[model samples]
Target: MEKKKVKNIFVEGPISAAFIGESIAKHSSNTNIGAHSIFLGQVRSDVLGENVVQSIEYTTYADMALEKMAEIREEIFAKHALTCMHIHHSLGIISAGEICLFVFTSSKRRRAAVDACTEVVERIKNELPVWGKEIFADKTHQWKENTL
Candidate 1:
């Protein structure tokens, strides 16, 4: 049996627009792909009492995260007719309004791509060992919790 290679999905700081554009552009030549679904997660400034969120510092257990991601990739591919899938998540400090997560999925049909993308995002949020520290404008911080 052939071993699957684990992909590194972590990107330092925030995800840039240019990087996302480049990633999309790279798939233009693949004629077999008929549909593409993309999801971008951004940091939002939420008011908690008197303090307002200014940024989020993200951290993860890299090795474990990658292992879990690889399993997810395999499962998603097995369940969906996906031609390609890409996931990128931010590490370090990401300011409000900055992109933190990017997920792209391509398939021969729209439904497969869309479903796979949504499932991958949900799994990442629910299963991954990534954590985020919400930093307030007043310099106070609190651990962030994942919400559906």
Candidate 2:
């Protein structure tokens, strides 16, 4: 089988509510989709030592991440009855309470959409080459570790 082209999933800065709303609105035309599941990952303000996280500066080995994501997309398509899926991750800085990652999955069934969306997010966290530098309110920073 011919391999599908890998999509560039990075968005500059934080993902916006407007952008996400538009994405959902665009899918309204797909009448075959009975259910859609979305996962939005946000930057959290967590206290670490004497400082609180203000934002996260995200970076990635894009080529590797996209390649691995393509493999993931193909695998998910094979294993699930999904109608469509979209994944977007932020690069650069995203403030606390802002969206950093968006995963949208749809299928003709609710269970498929829900299960596939969760699995895709987990794989992206574990398998993709994305990194986040947690920047504290006190101007200090720490590299984030994925709890995959």
Candidate 3:
């Protein structure tokens, strides 16, 4: 099959697990993948010894986010011999402990798929311009960018 199965980029106003599953399924199909791996990122409570996180408000630098996601996808494709990959992240208010991002990858072998999936997720967190606000149980909040 052609290498076009790999998604160049995917941007959403609000992302979900179901949406990510479908996108990955479609991208991995008709390819020669022997294994598929997926990683789902959920916002969690607590930030540097603070109260429980009530919700997470995520924002982006608009065009920068798109550019960054595109770069991430391209880098993954360049470095991995994979069938396809898809990354989706939420764009609005997401409750704490709820999933906000997903990284899915497929390859001809299990090892490559797993490695590529891991790399893609790490890159997105490191390089994307997506900002998040952690809402505390007391109704206060603080902005945070992904570190490492």
TM-score for each candidate, following the candidate numbering: 0.96, 0.96, 0.80
- Among all windows of ten consecutive residues in candidate 1, which has the lowest summed lDDT? 1-10
Candidate 1 residue-wise lDDT, 57-102, digit = tens: 9999999999989999999999999999999999999999999999
lDDT of 3 by residue, 39-118 (tens): 88887876657577878888777677676676667777888888877667777778876778877788888998899998
Question: Candidate order by lDDT, highest to lowest?
Answer: 1, 2, 3
Question: Model 1: runs farther than 4 Å from truth?
Answer: 1-3
User: What are the per-residue Cα lDDT tens digits for candidate 2 across 12-58?
Assistant: 99999999999999999999999999999999999977899999999
Q: Give candidate 3 regions above 4 Å deviation.
A: 1-14, 24-31, 47-50
Q: What TM-score, to 2 decimals, does candidate 1 have?
A: 0.96
Q: What TM-score quantifies how close candidate 2 is to the native fold?
A: 0.96
lDDT of candidate 1 at residue 92, scale 0 to 100: 99
Relative to the unseen true structure, what is the C-alpha lDDT of residue 50 in candidate 1, on a scale of 0 to 100?
96
